[model samples]
Target: MTQQNPGSAPDEESPAGDPWHAFGYLVAGVAMYGFLGWLADRWLGTSFLVVLGILLGAGLGLYMTFARFNRPPDPQSKQEKN
Candidate 1:
């Protein structure tokens, strides 16, 4: 019989294992697009273009959310323990 340490390292890559990576990407994309929207409002002197930019940013965020959830599991999951 053998005992496995409960504190043994996880089976996933730590940095890449974090689910927040997708969230960070989503926030960055949204912020960039929002800034574009503000710039458009400033240059065009109208809110229409700004609104459009925001909508486009929202679409990008939605797509990224879907992509993150669809990604395959970490490769370490396939490793065999002796």
Candidate 2:
């Protein structure tokens, strides 16, 4: 019998395969939304919009991360079980 390499990279469908990609998504969401909020604050002369924007961004990022990482396995992948 042949042994598989423990150090081999995981496939794209595995969450462990690309942690940085998920992190990038979260950071990008926060930065983009926060920047938008900052612009709105400057335009409206309000200090709260920036805070709101950051919160909204964080919530969205968390939701996206959870959704992407905690999904049901694909039906096609189940065929490999046999």
Per-model TM values vs. the true structure? 0.55, 0.74
* lDDT of the structure predicted as candidate 1: 0.70
**Most accurate candidate by TM-score:** 2
Lowest summed lDDT window (length 10), candidate 1: 9-18
Regions of model 1 farther than 4 Å from truth: 1-17, 72-82
> lDDT for each of the candidates?
0.70, 0.77
lDDT of 2 by residue, 1-82 (tens): 5453476443434443367767887888889889999999999999898888888888888888788778788886555434
As for candidate 1, its clashing pairs are none
Residue-level lDDT for 62 in candidate 1: 73
lDDT of 2: 0.77
lDDT of 2 at 82: 41
Residue 82: error of model 2 in Å? 1.0
